[model samples]
Target: MMTLLSAPTSPYVRKVMVVAHETGQIDRIDPVFALANPTKANEELNNQNPLAKIPALVTEDGAIFDSRVICEYLDATTSTHPLFPRDGKTRWQALTQQALADGLLDAALSARYELLMRPEDKQWSGWRDAQLAKIERALDRMNTDIPDTLTIGAVGYGCALGYLDFRFPEVDWRAARPALADWFATFSERPSMQATLPRD
Candidate 1:
């Protein structure tokens, strides 16, 4: 079995879990909870991943750090269901969607860290607002390009939006983005999304 080093609240970790479940590799992955913070630094995590990021996969061959690399590796391992398309156009669309989803997640995470991790006096309201603006722009673009079918990129986007709701419900993402809200409502019903939902 492969050991997955992950934080329960991390959107990146949740992405890998969602992919694993979607690709039918859930049973093969054993979840290992990790805290990626200055106070909770574990030497084992540093040894596996110098950056000390969550969602690292420890396989029989070696260890893989970062969610993108791990997700591709997992998708390649399975033959029956492919998370990434093999063709040129579809694959590019999926990859592009993944990038957009990642950007949204990055901005959201930055804002979250500013609020929760930094000291009250040290927190930068400007930086948090900038990140929030980026998230809003990304969400707007996503609403314009919302696909009829659920793809891998859509899964990633759904997970990213879900994380925002879980951690920062006060943001009220649904107010102006009714289309995205509807899409997310339907996306949330999937088994993969249900399985990887964030918990306190």
Candidate 2:
């Protein structure tokens, strides 16, 4: 079985797990809990992934890192439900959607890190506010262009929105984006998403 360095609370790891569940490849992966913090070092994780990131898949070929690459690799393993489109305009659109969701996650993480990781004296409200603003803009874009197909883009959006609910409930993103909220409610019912719900 391939090894998946993971953490229950990591949205990126959750994304990979959701894909594994969706593609009927969950049985093939062995999840190994790994700690990865930006300001700290995790030698075990660093050895496999220079970036010390979670959701790195250790395969016979080598270690595949970061969620996007690993998700694509997993999608290729089975034809059960191809998350990545083969080619053409749909491919680009799906990829763009994934990028948008990932960007939202990046901003959310940045905002959280500023409050949780930075020393109180060093933390900057302005920076955190900027990150939150970015997330708000991304939410508006996602609401405007919800994914109509089940691709990696949909998975990305699901995971990103779930992360917000898990970590930033105070943000109240649903009030302004009812359509996206409704989409997530339905998406969350999928076994893939239900099984990989983010938690601390």
Candidate 3:
């Protein structure tokens, strides 16, 4: 079995887990909790991933870091490439959508870290505001271009929205984007999403 340095609280890790679940590779992955504090060090995780990031998968061949790569790897393991389209326009669209979702997650995480990780005196509201603004812009784009199929893009969107709900409920992303909200509500019902709910 492959080992996954993971923490449920991480949306990126959750994205990997959701892909694993959807691709029927969940049983093959052994999830091991690893705290990935940017300011602190995790010896075990650092050994596998120089970046010291969670969701790093330790395969027999080697280690795979980054959620997007890990999700694609998991999707490739299955005979049917359900999460990723084979080729053509749909493929590029799905991949681009996934990137957008990841971008949203990046900004959201940055905003959270700025407020929670930085010391009171060191915290900068402007930085957090900038990150939050990015999130809002990303959200607007997602609202206009919601994913209509079950692809990596859909999984990424689901995980990102789920993270917002779990951590930044006060943001109220649903109010302005009903269509995207509806899409996510349906997507959240998937077994893959249900199995990999983010937690403390």
Candidate 4:
């Protein structure tokens, strides 16, 4: 079984875990908790992923970094459910939605890092506000284009929304985006989602 370097509260890791469960490939991976901090040194994680990111898959050939690439690798290798749509407009749509959702996650993480990693005196409210604005725009776009298919787009959106609930409870992301919230309400009930909810 391949080893998955992960943390329960990492949204990227949760995305990979959700994909594994959804594709019926969970048994093929061994989830191992990893303590990765950008400010601190993690030799093992650095060796596997130069960026020291989570959800790195230690595969037979080598290690894979980043959630999008890892998720695509899983989608291509797994045949049980096939989370990615085959070539067509649907494929492009799914990939585009995935990119949008991942961008939301990136914006959210950036804002979070500004607050959490930077010193209180050095933290810039302007930077945080800019990132938060990006998140708001992404949420609005997702509300307008909520996907109906079980594709990587759905998985990416689910994980991104889940991370918002986990990290930014004070920010009412659902209030202005009722349609997106309703879709997530239904998506969050899936077994794969239930199994990988981000935790402290």
Best by lDDT: 2
Write the residue-wise lDDT of candidate 4 on 10-29 in tens digits.
Answer: 99898899988888889999
TM-score of each: 0.94, 0.98, 0.97, 0.97
Q: What is the lDDT of residue 23 in candidate 4?
A: 85
Q: After superposition, how far is residue 124 of candidate 4 from its true place, in Å?
A: 0.6
Every candidate's lDDT: 0.86, 0.93, 0.91, 0.91
Residue-level lDDT for 49 in candidate 3 = 94
Q: What C-alpha lDDT, on a 0 to 100 scale, does residue 60 get in candidate 1? A: 88
Give residue 44's error in model 4 in angstroms: 0.5
Sort every candidate by TM-score, greatest first: 2, 3, 4, 1
Query: Residue 80 in candidate 2 has what lDDT?
Result: 77
**Backbone collision count in every prediction?**
0, 0, 0, 0
Candidate 1 per-residue lDDT, tens place, 103-150, comes to: 999898888888888989998899999999998899898888775665
lDDT of 3 by residue, 131-189 (tens): 99999998999999888888999998999899999999999899989999999989999
**Candidate 2 lDDT for residue 94:** 92
Give the poorly placed runs of model 3, Cα more than 4 Å off: none
In Å, residue 24's CA in model 4 sits off its true spot by 0.4
Query: How should the candidates be ordered by lDDT, best one leading?
Result: 2, 3, 4, 1
For model 2, which pairs clash?
A: none
Cα shift from native, residue 125, model 4 (Å): 0.6
